[model samples]
Target: MHAPDRPASYAHPARLILILSLAPTVGLGIGRFAYALVLPDMRDTLAWSYSAAGFMNTINAAGYLAGALFASRMIRRFGLAASVRWGTLACVLSLALCAITGNFYVLSFARLLAGVGAAAGFVGGGALAATIAQSRPERANFLLSLFYAGPGIGILASGLAAPFVLQGFGPGSWWIVWWAMTALAVVMTIPVLLAPFHARAALTETTAVKFAVAPVVIYLTGYFLFGAGYIAYMTFMIAYIRDAGGGAAAQSAFWSLIGVSAFATPWVWRRVLALDRGGLATTIILGVNAIGAAMPIFGHSVWLLATSALVFGVAFFAVVGSTTAFVRFNYPPQAWPTAIAAMTISFGIGQTLGPIVVGAITDALGSLSFALNVSAAMLALGAVLSAFQRKVRSF
Candidate 1:
């Protein structure tokens, strides 16, 4: 089924994975996480409450959940290039809309559409990565890890650029940052455009495999909590720093450090991730992440915030890789799509609820600190749940 007319530039796996990494850069880095950097200004300029601000992300997560459910079917029908192209194209336009509007409802709708686009790009790119890794099983794990780490590139770019964009355009122009993000996204689109749609010729997976989720239920639950807990910190950390009187330099340093640390994840956790201990590896990592999430509350020192950023940044992205590794370790190849999709849906549901709930807590408790404390507690709870999961015996 290979397309003879497809571009030959991405014919190799390494080259393909390199290009595929940009999918996350667009999907998560700009589509999702960039909101945090611009949140304070958006709040002030739009005159929105904490609850309303969080609702923006809530709608985004809802769209992401919907897209996750549909992406597989889309890939099956339309093929990878089309899926990724359309998804990234839509996401680019959605971000463009963000720069053009000041209406709260309109902005929320744009966020929602961006989420949908992000999911398509993410899922389609992930599938391509999987197919590529499968073709060369010896380097599968590293290739997959490389793909997931792509968001760090986006994170770093946003971290460095957002502050200057704000400074350059002056404080009240939050929309300018959105435009900068859109331009960066457009530049990243080139690699994708050059990628071909062909996967290996014999790449058929079973559609009728029946597998039990009981063994991994606890891991799945922990992942859900991880989703719920970690996002609140990302969604609110910039605002928290501002309230604590930290300046733009501090914000840029903190966020950029997190992004830089994330890029080193594959090397840092290569040994643990290589283990087949099921959720034990995940639990330990989540414990470290919980500590990082709580660090800002422990002290107002610059070193403390930097440490928090480095720790959380390093661990958070790897948690996602851990789940993918878990599925690969526990299931037959045919069942991977099902397993990964289940975990993603669980993660999405948790994310969809996290912002609203944490926002409400922020409103009621009169502090972002209390909301983050709640987030840390959820992560701790997730770690405990993950500790209960054992390796799947059938695998």
Candidate 2:
């Protein structure tokens, strides 16, 4: 009468995980990060202040915060598969909304809605991936990294297309790119909906088990700083490239390189992510991330920016996977959902303020370089804090 953790005959769990990854591909890669691609055009066409531009993502992250607050309840009520499909649908709708309207408030609303859906889809997909990852504990880190790397696919696809569309059609053509991405998100969602994610690692334990916070407080704070720092780079890097006289090709190259490097995370950090030392994996990844984020700040050389892209792209998503690894290492299977949501809440609060704060700093100081420096410093501080966290001993 008992069920297998996955289909007894499921020949390839990697294939299923790839399908599950489409949620993040839609939710993050295109739905969220693609904004960086169209920002310059939108800023020029709309005549908005840098602060106002940052508000768009700020609102999105706020919605993400709201969604993270409710994610544990939603997952417990609806199951992981339904939550992911629903969240992805929400993101698709938000993308369409962006294409049809230029009204600032409406667009903000659209961004907010996308954030809500992204958070929901992200949390659900992570849990489902975690469930799948349990099938092969030996490859746990690599498998989890594959799921987290899903966004890179989105980023790669968007980077290759969005910049060309913006450049060809000229300013005010941001809407066209949004429509293109909406279609892409739709296509991506189909695989996600079809993914076999029936395993329930934590559904029954929702009431019986509670996630502990005290042991992971330092790691959570480090994750919070990561959320704050990374967003600033992702949200504004394209604009920085444009400001520095990089053309569409340069921008595409930079963003696409990041996307390309993302695919390597699993192989590159598989060993580290397998470590049992809790936040040590995170500390190393975050240090690499901080170095990448700091690269362009020192100087925007072509090789330097490309190296930055390579380093940041590879580590950012892996840092996320490392947190999931931490949860898997320390918590029982049944507490996965609650633990992941708590981690997300900590990250959501940090990102909700990152873009806006960084934007305001850029606006006041009239130097994007200075803003990125501050962002890098936050990441470095996070790395240091995470270094001090040790593995939790379970009862």
Candidate 3:
């Protein structure tokens, strides 16, 4: 296949891919995931019950799962550009709804819609980018890493930006944060809209044949655990830090540090992936995650919290990048997106379960220590699973 003619600066294919990918990161990260950071404020402002807040998260996760399952079909029917445009528009409108409505039910509905939009945009955009970089699979891996890195950047941006917005503007500023994020989503669409079409037509027959492999199933299981463990910490870390007697600044800084580490992950993991044994390298990464999760339980100091963020940030995205690379190495190109979607669905399932399970433990036990312990256990199990991954040619 001849390379698509490159766009001028603003609409280059790589730039479009990055922009489309960023829309989901902002939607999922700031619109959906950042809810955890602002939950205390939202609950107090709205006088929402804990169950109501929990249900909102559940709805968001359910929507994400639905979108992931349907994304491939949506892209096949609508084409990548249309899917990206509409999906991003949905996310922007959903966040706008969130900014306008104070009704808990309405806000929850908007969040659910946002999740659906984010998943479709992310999966479709990622697949488009991967297809464009088919000749340079390693570059594809790097672009996918950039795709996943969007959420971390969003989280970091929200964490730092929200506190400042609240401090300068006073209470009920969470809505303002959503409004700003919505604008960014709209801005993100411009680059994507201007870029040349990069997605090739799908090969249904070849894809169907490639989806039958057993290694894919095992890979998905491992990814599910990764989601469970990672989300447990990400969702609660800000609250956990505050509850541990750290001030708001400390909490924000901790998340920012995680973001910084996450931003540098692709560069760092290029070295990790260069190691001789791919499976063993992944196991070591998972083990680092286990230790990171356990850090808060063992120490309450601000330094310890910072250490945890660093450990988690560095290892988390690297593991995800490694998983995608592993899948691509083991499967044919046409099947990559489906394999990724399957793994993502499993991961989303685990993520949905994580917050509820951790919330229950915190409610009953009056601390997050038990939840952290469970996270550690899950990561350790993931490490064990990584060891068993059939050694494909390392990326």
Best by TM-score: 2
lDDT of 1 by residue, 1-395 (tens): 12112234435777788788887788787888999999999989888889988888888888888887777677666666677778887788888999998988789888898888888887767656666666666666777777778888888999999977776777788999999999999999778877664643114432434657677788888998998999899999999988889777878888898889877887887777777886877887888889999998887788999999999988888888878877777776555555666777778888999999999989888999889898999999998998888888664
lDDT comparing candidate 2 with the true structure: 0.88
Candidate 2's TM-score: 0.97
| Residues forming the 10-long window of minimal summed lDDT in candidate 2 | 1-10
Off by over 4 Å in 2: 1-6, 199-208
CA lDDT, every model vs. true structure? 0.80, 0.88, 0.69
Off by over 4 Å in 3: 1-17, 49-51, 137-140, 199-210, 274-281, 391-395
Candidate 1 segments exceeding 4 Å error: 1-12, 201-212, 393-395
Expressed as tens digits, the lDDT of each residue in 215-333 for candidate 3 is: 44565666778777877677677767767776667867887887778778767676665443546667777788878888988878878888998998888767766766665555565
Backbone clashes in model 3, listed as residue pairs? none
TM-score of each: 0.93, 0.97, 0.87
- Candidate 2 residue pairs in backbone clash: none
- The global Cα lDDT (0 to 1) of model 1 is 0.80
How many clashes (backbone N, Cα, C below 3 Å) per candidate? 0, 0, 0
